[model samples]
Target: MSPTVLPAACEVLVIGAGPAGSACARTLAQAGREVLLVDQHEFPREKVCGDGLIPDAHAALRALGVYDEVMDRAFRAQHVRCVAPRGGHVDVPGTLAVLPRRELDDIVCRAAREAGARFAAPWRFVAPLLDGERVVGARLKGPDGEHEVQARWVVLATGASVPPLVAAGVCERRAPSGVALRGYVHHPELAQTLRELQIVWHPRLSGGYGWIFPGPGGVFNVGAGLTGSHATEAGGRASMRDVNLRQMLEAFASVHAPAAELLERGELRGDWKGAPLRCSLGGARWSRPGLLVTGEAAGSTYAFSGEGIGKALETGLLAAAALLEGGDDAAVRARHEAALAGLKPRFALYEKASHVNHRPWLADLVVWRARRSPRILRRMSAVLEERQNPGRLLSWRGITKLMFE
Candidate 1:
């Protein structure tokens, strides 16, 4: 068979080439498993994101052996500067980095290919192939035509896009979650003087925040996100409402001082792009017979923060580890399900906090306090570094004492 041709079958079929899919495929391939990894777009493609890699995300990449490569090309950010409206701000220390998704996605994917996973980019997944309710593989639309491929197990990691999940009945229906808009901006300050990632708490974007992450080549990733809890209800149904995310993004920049300061002198690289963030913090169905869903397709994004990459990479590694445990199909499925369950406490806590965070004033208060008090600032840093429980921020004391005191 010619190189680049899709094989009829493999031991594992991994969809998506982003961090989650690539990581899973790399781990499986390194473990002596035949793997087929596919993505709809070619490498180095645009992915709308804040591009901020926190401690959890960095740890996952480091474990996968591609963290240093990304760091070599990324802008190293040591602290996160959280700004409240009306000029209140606090700087929390952490190990964060910014690398555009194009480069970040391609780098990890290259690692996967080097590990012996057969990769086929520019190929789209049409639907999952099923044998009496068990997924065998998926139908991939390649350059030639639609081709059916079979595998012993499938790891669905298609980030962002949800059609494949819906088509396979993996996800029946979901409520409106969150929406975000992001774009690259060219500003000389990024290279000249800017040093930290700026996270702004604004009253305009309910249950969300605006961010400015320094990037390479004099450009930085800037964006805003809004949770569905505050989005307008059209006929009282969130699914039917049309969210003008671009407008929300623009509004944030115009009001937030730090963001506006940069926008005043910098230029947006291209038109604003946006995507829907599905937060399945309430225990969405993630695994089925012969199929395990990773990444955004499984609703892995953290509520309010919209942090998915960390969770995605974590789940991807968990999926591979479960299969590597050496067991039959049923045992493998059970292991994967249990591994995923371990992450639910944090997800559930974040979900609960996100609801109370719908009150933007609370964000303003936290940011204000963090800036004024050193102890609170250190505590905030602990939360960012994952050393403290975020669920506490959702408690009654968190809502009243933390916000008011």
Candidate 2:
């Protein structure tokens, strides 16, 4: 239920209670700060995501003190099968699991509340409350009515939703970095057969890839993503691609036999859904005077793999740490910006590797080589664990090395 009363003031006001916002609120509240966590949707609401958790996500969950709780409920997997266009595949081993965002996010949000953060839902951020250029709070609308709440610091963690960032004057690019569509299928037989997280690349879904991840019970997450849908043209204008994701999914099934069988034999549990993605940390300013942006709002998703949950949680923790440092506004902003800058180089590498999504033959080559060379397979596993730079495996230098080695 929505909170009947909204606090007039808080030490920290976190908007958008996804992984990022909830992580921030949890950290701040655990530090004894008065935190108010608000979201436009209520708890356990459905969120579109691949729901694959890798090693980084595991680390973040451990830090948040909810690792065991999440692991207990998540569908565990040992490997991710990367399939090339020609049906070649390589299994990269890692610590992996899958739990729907509806469940995963609710657990994190509940952790925040348990840490003493005041939680409220169905409260939409209307605008930023500013004293000149510094954000003082936000005007929120809920079932009760529209109301203004004050806070020393405001955090924007709204994932892929641009309006809140625009209202707060932090949005840099109006266009999303990419787009994706996904749906769940409930077939116990299919789920039992698909033990690994499967990623498929094909020319038909250029600038993106298709994934079939096994979820708890009989559900399997199936979808395709287009990372180049909003590529910026040479003339500085956004070049929008007119592509139908539903058709793309159909094409994926046509080309990939497992996907075809899944669709043909399994029962789709819900309508297919799509969501915009912000990637490579390029679409927004990380912070201003009194506001900070984290999560997909700040482009936390990786361009190559479209994974953002771990980074979103990590960025949220960074935001909370900057506030906990107890410095002047400039100092706090500087710290947060530096933290994001540290991750920029890694995001750039992923962006470089995303070229494989557009040129899928590269994936086929890599998979073929990986199947032949144990060294290449080890590097691929490192890439998934984030131990090695993705460029080391996807760049021209990497490709040349793969051929000779």
Candidate 3:
């Protein structure tokens, strides 16, 4: 594939070479379409995340033909253990995997390059090029200087970032839906504990939670996060920046049964890092003439669990399919929006579940019930497998089963 310089145009221009962008770019290029993928950062750049991929994410990787490469470098997680504030817990086993985002993202992006997408890195998107209300392409800034690259269509995969959407006037500039702080930990028992993926909930963290996930090579991804709207949902008055995630993590690790056990067994391996977990629930318009939003920009992250990687790739592929549906730009936009709308109800319930997770009492009851009932435990396991919908928490039978189990 020949390279298209910044000043040139292509059939498709995908901004932000993350999972969503790469997925879209790869799909387009593999179909013999002209695609140019741009990113401000080079490969192997750091991206803060839990780094755990559930079964659904694996399916996405398989579709992209990178699952084997990923699995070769990842740790296959065995059990998912959820801990409640009252020390009640449930441990269910499943097929999950963990790999640092820095590595996994690079692999996915490179797959795009190999599949024939022209990739340009360290090229920052400065603004949108609009002809009337249509986004013709983007004005990008890089070492060569500012220039415009026109495209038949523009796809935004700029996760949790606002400037791209703001520049396009697709939505008002705002922050990500939530915040997450993560870091690596080296533990003597990390290798053994890699069998269990732990999610810890605490009363103090009404709108947030802590996690201890074992990674490959004696390191684990240990962290905590609070939804940006957590305070508002919890009826607290704390500012977004005012909360110390590291401190909260320390508190949970020192007291919570699951977190404390890991802390006692491991040593903090590096500096505690964090990032914003942008949500899909906001009022952001997903599509306009010649432009569409996928990935985190489309609020693809599940509000309750902060699980997005699967949804990110899902939306990317969905957008790609819409492009191939052979419609005008307006018809394409409608196709993508309608497909994404199917997830809105689930996303809303996930947000409500995030709110409910903040309530220690209800969370404890659910955990306590699941811990005892084999049937509920099986269903819990199914949720991780995507066989059961997480939104089932809103169903009457689901509620009865959860509470009465």
- Candidate with top lDDT is 2
Global lDDT of each candidate: 0.79, 0.92, 0.80
Question: Order the candidates by lDDT, highest first — what do you get?
Answer: 2, 3, 1
- Could you tell me the lDDT of residue 197 within candidate 1? 90
Task: Candidate 1: list runs displaced more than 4 Å.
Answer: 1-4, 174-176, 229-243, 281-284, 403-405
Q: Predictions ranked by TM-score, top down?
A: 2, 1, 3
RMSD of each: 2.5, 1.1, 3.1
Candidate 3 has its poorest 10 consecutive residues by lDDT at: 230-239
Q: Per-residue lDDT for 1-405 in model 1, tens only?
A: 222488899999998888889999999999999999988888878898778888989999999999999999999988988776666777889988888888988998999999999888778889889899899989888777788889999888876565777766676445546778888889876457778998776667656778888898889788888765434455653453444766667777787765776677788898678877777533246778888888777777888578788878888899899888968778988998788788878777777777644666666677766767787777778888878776676466775767567
On TM-score, the candidate that comes out on top is 2
Q: Tell me how candidate 2 scores on lDDT.
A: 0.92
Question: So what's the TM-score on candidate 2?
Answer: 0.98
| Candidate 3 Cα lDDT to native | 0.80
The backbone clash count of each candidate, in order, is 0, 0, 3
List, residue by residue over 277-346, the lDDT tens digit for candidate 3: 7775464788889998899888888777788888888889888888978689879999988889877876
